[model samples]
Target: MTHPIPIFIGVDPRERAATNVLIDSLTQNSSVPLAITPMVTPQLEKQGLYWRDRDPKQATAFSFSRFLVPKLMGYQGWAIFMDCDMLARGDIAELWALRDDQHAVMCVQHMHEPNDTVKFLGEPQTPYPKKNWSSLMLLNCSRCRALTPEYINRATGLELHRFHWLAGDHEIGEIPGGWNHLVAVQDPAKAEESPLLHWTLGGPWFREQRTMGEGLAAEWFAARDDAFRLWD
Candidate 1:
């Protein structure tokens, strides 16, 4: 029997609705079965799985808790992690197929630098190298032994997000940029046609960001409406 593709998504109370919409979009577009879990920090903390203080630079609740995926998976198989504030416009199976076991982790590498000083919910935006690389990743869990709970709890933000625990740069792999096309930070041409679209600046979910990604937000709203229809 084929195992369902495993996926972990960041979930902040502030964006819980956004997370649901993302899950719906993924399930709607995927050709394969998926096991999607939300990385709700409070739940992880209550279980003693995550205990790190939120970094001042962290724009969202899952900024650091995301590093726990390997341990959460028992370091047994591959899994994908994605930020909640995104919409999958194509088959997630395609992204799953890009997983390369040769490397410990695979993600769409981006040189994104957002011009906005603040994002949705008035969160401060901090620029650093490889800022959004960890937002979406395919992990070879067995190869990511360095992501232990202890290390993740004490490690600096850059250490975890930039693949610092890996043996070297050679252990990191790259997926196609189209899979994580940042909404306003990347080329509009690509973000407009890309299979995956990320609202790195802010998504239309927040009242303040309702008009942030205007041209690129139709799919997000469509997915949002579809997801809420079940509840209403």
Candidate 2:
């Protein structure tokens, strides 16, 4: 029998609702088998890996937890790491099928600044180079020895995200933009075609964000309701 694909998601402990709904969306659309692991803060803490969210601009439970994905996989086979605020409209198998072994990591190279002044929970929208590239990654773990616990524990956000750990930019590969389409940033027409909808700033689940036009909020709500039923 074929083994299921391993997917590690970075879920902020505070955003359980969004995380669960993201899981539901993946399950609803994925054609391939998956071993979904939500890398919660408490669980990582229990394992002696603290959530070192030292940056004032970042506070998501998995803001830094995503770096642990490769280490957790024992630097073995390929694994996918995604932010919890994403909703999948296309089959995950399609994304998985795009994997190439030549590169250490693969993600959409989003190339624009965020329009908003603040992000979810009013965090300052600090725009840096290669923003959101780390939000969704297809890791070739065997070649990703640099993401070790010790390195990730002390590295600054820039060092971790700016391809400092890798040999050079060529080691990083690119994926299609539709796979990590950012909400509120992409052209409305293009956003509609994206297979993955990422609420990089925030989503409709928040009471204060209900009026925000996600264009795909309905799908998130429907998925959230489905996830709620499973837990009930």
Candidate 3:
């Protein structure tokens, strides 16, 4: 309780609204104080922490920047990383309590098979083992020393997302699947079972994909509206 729990979120200009709502949801549903830091690409570039060229297949600005959390934390204590397109329906303190120091990083090992060839903004969907696993992580920074600024800037997508930095898959711990429930790729009914909702395909913020997850879309819309109402 001495310090607020550090939470690093991936942020993109296009998903600013999503990010804002996510922050609102996190604080609203958390018992503990949070130190939420958005890994904004522009700021990272300005600070000389990130300088990777935009990949055509990259859907968001923070796709690669998420790997730099350990370095950002001075490779010290534990910290969390989550995507902007998420809504926290349960207390974030629960998730924070699951952080285990035995592993380098922990995340939900999702069996994400793309339901579509493209996602929001016509971004190509590249399917691979353990896709959204990196989307949410409990980073034990000292153990993740392999995630240097130089390594992050140039590592391939497979290497970064699949956790090639760690010694083996065993080093990568697993969190409950509900913490990172993928909206469209996973079952719509299961959406209600999850504490967090992830609009990996796209969220209600995007016009065309607004209804991407049917029943689950309402959750994000409600969160967004509530966030807006609070702001007003």
Per TM-score, the best of the predicted structures is 3
TM-score of 1: 0.95
* lDDT (tens digit, per residue) of candidate 2 on 22-96: 887888888878899989878887897664655776657677768888889999999999998888888998999
Model 3: per-residue Cα lDDT over 96-190, one tens digit each: 89988889999999888776778888888888899899999999999999999999999998899999989999998889999998887787778
lDDT of 1 by residue, 183-212 (tens): 867667877568888898888888777766
Off by over 4 Å in 1: 230-232
State every prediction's TM-score relative to the real structure.
0.95, 0.93, 0.96
Report how far off residue 152 is in candidate 2 (Å).
0.7
- How well does candidate 2 match the true structure in TM-score terms? 0.93
Could you report the Cα RMSD, in angstroms, for every candidate shown?
Answer: 1.6, 2.0, 1.4
Off by over 4 Å in 3: 230-232
Candidate 2: residue 163 lDDT (0-100): 63
User: lDDT per model, in order?
Assistant: 0.87, 0.83, 0.90
| Model 1 CA lDDT for position 17 | 79
- Model 3 lDDT, full chain set: 0.90
The weakest ten consecutive residues by lDDT in model 2 span: 210-219
